[model samples]
Structures are given as structure tokens and as C-alpha cells.
Target: SMAQDAINRVLVDRAREGKFVVRLKGGDPFLYGRGYEEAHACAEAGIPCTVVPGVSSALSVPALAGIPVSNRGMTHEVTIVSGHLPPGHPGSLVDWEALARMRGTLVVLMGVKNSPAIADSLMAGGRSPETPAAIIVDGSLDGQVTHRCTVGTMATTLTDRGVRPPAIVVVGEVAGLPQVLTRA
Candidate 1:
């Protein structure tokens, strides 16, 4: 977390110097990137910090791969979760069981390394093993790769494909949406 600490310090220092500082980040900063911490630091120093909204990979990545996180009459809810913490970790706040019961799209970020445990937790928590799943690597950029599989085989499929971080994992019916309909 040293890098983040350094970032916060820089933001505070620049704001204190009465300079406008823009901390550009990939996706929505607040999603899981600790944008709030930086904002809080600025506030504590009585500095003005304006937030500019940006696209999040949770939605954009899937769309780029011709997968919609939600579709009319197909799915109305979408849940985005951080896979940074493995299931059952003491510090983890995500309710895997509840997420498992949700009948909607589940988009997981930074979960590539822990996909097996995540998939296991979902299935154990009542999610169907056959649920359609997809992994979009290096999404929204050139050299992006999309791999489709069932929840039961998601981890193995990712491994077989040599999938890595900076990927989005979409689960549910939406992941299996017809390609023809999604083509722009």
C-alpha cells in the first residue's frame, strides 16, 4: 500500500500548494481504487477537490466483448464485486452467499488469480454450476481476449487460456448473450 500512501501524500501536498491536481485513474476511481481516500485527504486539508466521473470496466469491458451486463427481460440487476479478497478472508466484506443468490449479472474485478476460490464459493452458496461465465482480459484495449465458459469451468478455462489480471469476469445469462444481437 506504499504506492497508494505516496499518491495520497502527493495529492495533499499539491492541494496545499493551491494547485489543481487531477488524479486520473482507470475506471471509476471510487469503485475500488481508493479515490475516496484521496478526496478525504484533500478535504482534511480544506482543499477543493472536484471529482470527474469516468467509465468503469464493470460495464465497459463486457460491452466491448459483445456482452451486456444487463438485458431487457433477461436480467435487470447487475452486481459488481471486487475479487481482490478471497472468499472467507477475515477482512473481506463481500457477502458471497448473498451474491450467489442474486439472479443477475455478476461482474468481478481483479479476481483472475482467485477465480477458483470465487467460483467455488458461488457454487457452494447456491449458484448454478452451469451458469454462463466469461473472462475478458485487457478489456477495452487492443490485444483484448474474451473467453466464454460455464461457472463450473471458469477457473480451468481461464487457466487454459493463460488469462491474467486487469480482466473482468462476467457471470450469469448475460455472459451468454447472442453475439448477433450484441454486434454493433
Candidate 2:
């Protein structure tokens, strides 16, 4: 968190110096990047801060892997969540059971480490084991690798493929649509 502290300090300093400072970050700064903390700090210091929107990996990653989050009548809703915490962890705010029951695309960010537990929770919560799932590593980059499987086998597939962090996990019918889409 020191990095974020440093960033906030710099923003405050630059604003006090009457200089316009733009904070550039990967994906959308507001999503899991603590962009609001910096904005709040700037405002408290009487600095005017402006936010320029950017594409979030939740949308871009699946798209890069040729998986649309919402496809016509297939799905109209998408729920994006952070997978940083295990399902039962006291610090976790995500309700795995609720998510499992949701009939929509599920996009999980930073959840690779706890994927096994997450999958188990989803299945135990009544999500079909055969539900389509995908893990997109290095998404939207030249080194991107997309692994397709069912929710029942997602963890094993990721382990077998040596999939690591900084990846996106997509689940639901939309996840399987890539097979039907014509690839260019």
C-alpha cells in the first residue's frame, strides 16, 4: 500500500504546486485500483481531480479471448467481482452462493489463487458443475492464453496448465460461446 500512499502524496504535492497531474493506470483505475482513495485525498487537500474512464479487463479480457460477456438473448447481465479472498474468509464480502445462483456472466478478477475453493463453493451452492468456464491469462496482451473448461474442472485445468495470477476467470453460458463464434 506504500505505492498508493506515495501516489496520493504526489498528487497532493503537485496540486498544491498548481500543476495538473494525470494519474495513469492499467485498466480502469476505479476498479480494484483504489482510484477513489487518491481522488478523496486530492479533494480533501482542496485539489480538483478529474477521472478519465478506461476499459476494464473484466470486459476486455473475455473479449480478447473471443468471449462476449453479454450475447443477445444468451445473457443480459454480468457480475464482476474480485477473487482476492477465499469464499469463507472473514474479510471476504462476496457471497459465493448468491453468485452461483445468478443467471449471468461471472467475471472474477485476482481470484486465481483461490479458484479451487471458489469453484467448489459455486458448485456446492447449486451452480451446475458442467457450467462453461474460462481462464484468460495475460489478457489483452500478446502473451494471452485462454483455457476453456467447465466449472467442475476449472481449478485442475488451471493447475495443469500452470496458470498464474493477473488473469481473468469467466463463467456462465457466455463462456462457451467462443466455440460458436467465427474467429477472425
Candidate 3:
């Protein structure tokens, strides 16, 4: 990530000069898209910015791939988190231990690389090793691929399948609803 703050400043500076600047992003800009942050930057500089909402992949990705993030009474609650930071990182805001204990769905975005560490954290925090997990890659794209495994085999599945970034990792029973899980 090239100094995002710097880019925000550039956008503000250009807008200050009467230049029409645009920041186009995939998914919802307000939902972890930093649209709010950029808007704040503009407001601090007295520049005007507008935010348009888009369908969040968090709800759409799994849905498009035949995985329902929620069901009738099967899923009472859902917790979405960012896995960019592995568990135990000082900057990480996620409480993997608490999440492990939650009786709900856990959806992690941008966690392909840290899937191993994440798996360990969830398991260490009391999550079942047999908890169903799914990795939806290239979501909503022509090349989309869904990888299924249990929390115990998440790291191995990822490693063995050559899973890459731009993936959404679903850790919960809902993930296994599609079919029987394939062990790594």
C-alpha cells in the first residue's frame, strides 16, 4: 500500500485547485473502503466529497458462490472482521479468542496469507478444529474458486491448494452447509 495518507492529501490538494478528482473502488467504499476516511480528510481541508454505496462482498461473495452467510434460525448472529493483521499483533483489533467462543458466523476478509496463524488463534481460543471453513477466492469473478476444509485443515488446505490473496475466509458451520468438507 503506497502511503495512502499521501494519496489522500494529493486528492485534497487537487480538489483544492478546482480539479475534479475521483476515487473509484470496488465493493462498498464506506465499508472498509476508506471512503469515510477520505471524506474526513476532505472535510478537514474544507473540500467536498460524496460517497456512493455498493454491494459489500462480505454478504455477496459467499452468497454468489452458493454459501449463505446466514440462514433462518441456524445463524442468529454474524461477525465480520479483517484478518490483515494476524492474532497477537499489537495493532490488530480482532479478539480471535472471543470470536472463537462466539456461536455465530465469522467472516474474514483479506486473510489468505495469515490463514495459518488465524487458524491457530481460533483453535487455541477454544474453537473446534472440526469447525467448517471455506475460502472463496476471486470472488464474484469468472475464475472464482471455493476451497472447503475444517479449521484444523485451513492452513493445510490453503498451502496445498496454492490459495492466494483477494480471498474471503468463512469460519463457521454455515461454510460447510454447501457439502461435505474435503480434508487437506
Candidate 4:
């Protein structure tokens, strides 16, 4: 259903015919939403277009759970990454070593299935095993569950606890900062 070429063809045809069309997509239209590709197609076809932003899963989920990703003196940067690649993409496309070397907070979406591998790679690439990592399941929903642990133990912790998909994972120094988490 995520065939970009098919969607692009439709948008291009409509734009060429001077017809107005709303390309509705779930989640933030910009963030991993393929909005850029569609926009490019429309523009190249001489079509005028505008973008209306939608709530991204990254911020919305944390907010609903009362976790403010950014807190003064705690964290100022957050990185959001896609856990799954486009169909047919190589399994090891992520540069785990570079990501590990980064200093800001990290947020990974659609990454439940690959969480174990990701954790292993990050640690192998030099990220601290003690680095705090959290897996948030059904984030923002009534059944939301947040499993917090260090990066070293995350893979085992998640497996032992049986946490599953439709989830997001966060890792960084900020994740360890106690002040930002909701006091339960």
C-alpha cells in the first residue's frame, strides 16, 4: 500500500490536468510521510500545492504520556529515526556507529522488531551500555507501556518482559535524567 511510484503517478496526472487533490496521509505529512516525494512530483508537473501539518507520532505519544521530550538543562535536542526501511532496503542501512557517537537524544519509530539488533549495534559501536533506553508501546493509547532500562540490558529486558510493537524507542543521556519523566 506504500507504493510511492503509484502515488506519484496519480499525483502527477492530477497536477497535469490542473485538478485539485488532497493527498491525505497518516501521521506527520513531512516526517517519513513521503510528503517530499509527492510535493516534488506536483511541483515538477507545474502544480501549485500547499502542505498542512499533522501531529507526528514522536511528540504526540510522549505528550499524552506526560513526558516532555525537551526540558531546560536536561535535553535540548531530539532525533527521530525510522526503524523500518522501505521495502527491499538492505537490513543494515543504519549507521549505528555514527548514531552512537551523536550526543543528543534519540527516538526511533516502528523499531520494535529490530530493537534487539539496534541495541546490540549501538553498544558495539561505542554507546554506553548504561545509557538509558526506553521502549514505549502503543504510545499515547490507553494501554501505553514504557519500559525503561539501560541500552546494554534493553534487548534482554524487552524480551523478558514481552513488550511488542506499534511502539517507539528512545535513547540518550536525557532518557536517564529523572526530572523529565512523569512522577508516578
Candidate 5:
């Protein structure tokens, strides 16, 4: 809930003072991390800032749980969206209906609180209620848990499993792929 502009000011101020600053952010900054925005702010303030790409949990979390986003004939697409704002929210631009119609994996970031709404919208948009679903909580950290269920039971599974923020939700056939498609 921190303001980007507020942090931008500090970055600019420190750069002006010739203080070398390194902003370490988990995951790829451009992948809904607002890292580009920070770089833009630095550029606008005439500060020389560089953004180093990092691994994104949207892709890594599922992989950590042995879910390949795309495999030969498994799926040809992988869609990642932020569930920070539930579907239908004025601030949300995600088209849950269109996503529901797509064939591939759907990964949601920061969607713990809106899992219910998200599942409901996808089902209402024509996605099968029995569609496979999984939530990788506390991804890449100690005690990480991968909760499995169907899209229909996502809401309940999340609650029953005690899923929380900083989790990645995977919906589609890929969610059920808990084993490496191949080891070669």
C-alpha cells in the first residue's frame, strides 16, 4: 500500500546526493511489480537508474510446484494477471470472461483475498467449474504449500488451506501437472 511517487522522491533525492542506491525487489519489476514506474520516475528526475530483471513468481512458483506453464501439447499460452483488485472492480482492467474463454494456464498474483470472486467470475464466464486449480502459497520460501482443488472449490480450498498473500494461484490443466513433463 505504499505510494510509488513517495519512494520515487527518495530515490531522486539520494541520487542527487551522489549516494549509490540499489533497489532490490523480488520478481521481475515489469511483471506487475511497478519497477518500470520507478525507473520512469528516476528518468523524469534526471537520475541515472538501472533496472535489473529478476525471476517472477508468476512463472517460478508454479514451476517450483512442478507445474509447467507451457508444454508441447499441454498448452500454448500462459496468462498472468493481478488479482489485487477483484474482477468487476472499477480499478481492475482484467477481463475475467475473456480469460475464462482462453485455453491455457491462468496465474494470479496477490489474489488470496479475491479467490472467491475470481473463481465465481471465471465459472460464470463459461469456464468449467471442475477446471483444475492450484495455489502455491509462500512460494519459494520455507513451509511453502501447494494447495490443489478445482476452480469450483478454489474459494473453499484457499480458506481451508490457510492460503495467504504473496501466493500465486494457477488455474488450468497445468495446475494438475505436479510432475515434470520430461527430465531430458
Candidate 6:
């Protein structure tokens, strides 16, 4: 729970010794990177810090699977959420109902464990049951698996297939584009 705090202390001590510190984080620092915590700690200790962003699994994974999240006349807006945590966790504290109700695309990173639960919640909150859904595992890596199904069947289908973590689950019309074009 104090991972960032520990990192901050190290950075602060290093800075006090007149050394410059570079903290590298996975994915966009501002987007659930928890960089803010470290930054704040460094600032309070009179240590200067800069934030650098990395490609996140949210967009990169789908792209590697040949799925464009947003296409002209297809989807204009895209929302990235996390499936790694439960609905109450800070990581998964998204308004699933509102997101499900949006007209744009939905990309869920690290959501394999909770994808089924998430799908159920969205459907219960009025998202279309027929909405296309996909689980992309090990995105942008050598071993990538894409599981295509519908929101209605996401829970059961994903469970039946034993989909795991380190995957991105996409929901909405954009997900159907690849499935239809490739017949996957």
C-alpha cells in the first residue's frame, strides 16, 4: 500500500544528497500511475521531479490486436478503465453505468479477473446486452490472445475460457469491428 511512499523516501534522500532522480513508471503517470503521491512527497522534501508517460496497456493492447479503438464514423470517444480491482477499489472506481451508457468506446486494462463482473454490472445498469466485448491477453507482446464475445455472454464465456490477468477487455461497437472484419 505504501509502495509510492517508499519510492518517495528514496528519491527524497537521493535529492538531498544533491543528486537528480528519475522515477520511471509503467503507463501514463497521471493515469493511475500513482506518480502524484511520489511527486508530492518529493516536493515537500524540496526535491524536484518530472513525470514521464509510457504507453499503457489500455490503448496499446487493442492496437496490437489490430483493433482501432476510435474510427471515423465508428467511434469518436474512448474511455479507459481498469478491471484489476473491484468496483470499490481506487483503480476500478469508475462509473460503470455512465460509461456503459456512453456512445463511445470502452477500454479496460488489467481487467481479466473482473471482466465478467464488470459486464454483469454494466448490463444490469442498462448497457446493451448485445454490446460487443473482447478480452486481449498479453497485448503488444509475442503471445497475445483475443477472446471475442458479447456483453451478455462475457461473464460465462470468459470464465469458460479461463481468461486471466494482464489483459485488456474492450467493450462497445468498436470491439465488433475487428470481429466482423476478421470473422474472429
Estimate every model's Cα lDDT from 0 to 1: 0.89, 0.91, 0.89, 0.78, 0.88, 0.79
TM-score of 3: 0.92
Per-residue lDDT, model 5, residue 101, is 97
lDDT per residue as tens, model 1, 64-132: 898989999989899999999999999889999999999999999999988899999999999999999
Q: By lDDT, is 3 or 5 better?
A: 3
Instruction: Give one digit per residue, the lDDT tens place, for model 3 in 1-184.
Output: 6577998899899998899998888989887788888889999999988888888889889887778888887788889899999999999999999999987899998888998999999999999999999999998888888998999999999989999989999989899895543323
For model 4, which pairs clash? Answer: none
Worst 10 residues of 5 by lDDT: 175-184
lDDT of 6 by residue, 1-184 (tens): 4566687788899889888778777677777687788889988987777777788767777877777888899888999876677555565568887887787889987677777778888887789999988888777667778988889998887778887777788888888884433323
Q: Compared with the true structure, what per-residue lDDT tens digits does model 5 show for residues 87-117?
A: 9999999999999999899999989899899
Leading candidate by lDDT:
2
Residue range 113-178, candidate 2, lDDT tens digits: 999999999999999999999999998677888899999999899889999888999999999874
- CA displacement after TM-score superposition, residue 175 of candidate 3 (Å): 0.5
Better of 1 and 4 by TM-score: 1
Q: TM-score for each prediction? A: 0.94, 0.94, 0.92, 0.79, 0.94, 0.86
Model 2 residue runs over 4 Å out of place are 180-184
lDDT of 1: 0.89
What digit string (tens of lDDT, one per residue) describes model 4 on residues 16-124?
A: 7777788998778899888988888888877888988899988777665555667687777887888775222476466777888876777888888878788887777
